[model samples]
Target: MKSELDDQLCRKYPTLYRDRHGDPKSTAMCWGFDCGNGWFPVIDVLSELLSKHNAEVYASQVKKQFGSLHFYYSGRDKYTDGLVSSAQSLSSMLCEICGSQALIQTKYTGWFTTRCKEHTKDYSDKEYVELDVSKVAYLGFGKAWSALVLILIDSCDWRTEHNGMPATHLSITKEAGKLIVSHSGGDDFTYTIRSLHARFQ
Candidate 1:
């Protein structure tokens, strides 16, 4: 997926993706969603369903493997498991390039992909799938586009823990000409805006 959609999803559904930028050792999500743009709807629908579910479920990794959708996750009930299974099955009949109808058979060229007629010829044995950007909007990430950024800023952070914290009543006195930043929560690990970006990014 384009980095825009990827970032949008990670930021929109913070709880579902808190680990997306975390240490790879702690989460396969750090690799991010590894699939084509066509599967956006499938992922979108599934994410909506999973998010509404009462459990604190999360996906560890989402990718395409062997001409099929592979959504590996942890913390699921019987219904959520069924939802994942159904999404995987649905991918079998849809083009991985355009999300249109296609013959997703059990096999294809030695290196295979499930593609519609328009995209089948574009497949190659030497290359991994890299899809073009499509027009589909990942607006399903949230309902309100206007408030999404503000909502995300407060609700999501690269580190779910206190990114920059001190205490409720914090102190920030410039030692010399340099500036300082602190919160009431605790002393901030990063003292400058640029440093915070560097540390988080």
Candidate 2:
């Protein structure tokens, strides 16, 4: 009976190759259905199976490298229109802080980042300091762009837990009652000139 069913499927979708393992009874074991070649139901089943394995492998790799994996069920193949729509949604969501269209979707990784040429140069300048307020502002904005940087600076060096703490790689410059902070690490945090003096005092 199973052989009859397999024969019918093979006849219906001529492109689907038999499973290399020679298991005619196992529909799940079949392969060789190139994109757009297989019947819709067969394609759906194959896509689900492939995606499940791929997701597991990708999640494990991400966890090993980044210490965490933030996977969400996106209901779309990475190469499909669904993925493109999701990317656009994400870009819109971050528009307030990074500005609309500022986030660039990485082609290789499909990840999004707000770091652009101007921002990159700004961060590079943070590593060195001259007396320029504009340079200091550039660094400060970089820090403001990332909350992690603020937490590190506020908790580690600027707070009382460690006194005479070596100044953060970040340095502050005051001009016309505005504070511009720059870091060699490519971050900038700025505050009102008065607020900075008050915090230190």
Candidate 3:
């Protein structure tokens, strides 16, 4: 998937494959895609905008947090913010997990994510699935995005949490010999939580 994505990015936006001094390279040097595959279209849009202007842009950060997608870049000037804002707006309507048309933001285990009605799960009204936190499992770890998220697979209907409030505080600790991860906008391990928090701060 990484190779395929790289190839596609290069072919679609060759300017991303350039060196710092504006020399085109065989591989993209400074670009990054830190979000899920669902936001590929948003990335494509941003890439196109950068390429169209020969802007020498470098994508340094991209992620989904607080139930929305975040696309940040280095080497940006006045023209880039507009493109980033547009992409982010589109991401709110699109599911972060599957790119479906999302009508609501869902929360699971104190973490928030945007999902379509079918994929959303309501843990309070329905039975809470016993999450096996004994073993270390990445709740929202991906090569692309570094967002604080709680993912529930094959669950009941989802209930909203935080009422669209942006996540502002996060913490994690040990409880009953299990990792108790929490995030803001809702509900983390200390080092892991701190590192993730640093990304936002």
Give the CA lDDT, 0 to 100, for residue 149 in model 2: 31
Q: RMSD, model 2, all Cα superposed?
A: 21.1
lDDT of 1 by residue, 109-201 (tens): 575466666676655434333322121122222212212222222222332355443323322333453323244332222222222211211
lDDT per model, in order? 0.56, 0.30, 0.47
The digit string of per-residue lDDT tens for model 2 on 1-201 reads: 134433554454333322323444643234222111112222223333334334431111000001111122223343322222222222221222223222222323443333334333433332322212242344454432232233334533442243443344656555565444555431122122112222321
Stretches off by above 4 angstroms in model 1 are: 105-109, 124-201
Model 3 misses residue 179 by how many Å? 49
Expressed as tens digits, the lDDT of each residue in 1-201 for candidate 3 is 145665677677665544323323432243445455766665666677666755577654556767677765566654465455545655665666576656335354666565655556652233323323322245333312222122211000021232332333444444564444454542112222232222321
Worst 10 residues of 2 by lDDT: 59-68
TM-scores of all candidate predictions against the true structure: 0.57, 0.16, 0.48
Q: Return the top candidate by lDDT.
A: 1
- Which candidate number maximizes TM-score? 1
Candidate 1 TM-score over all chains jointly:
0.57
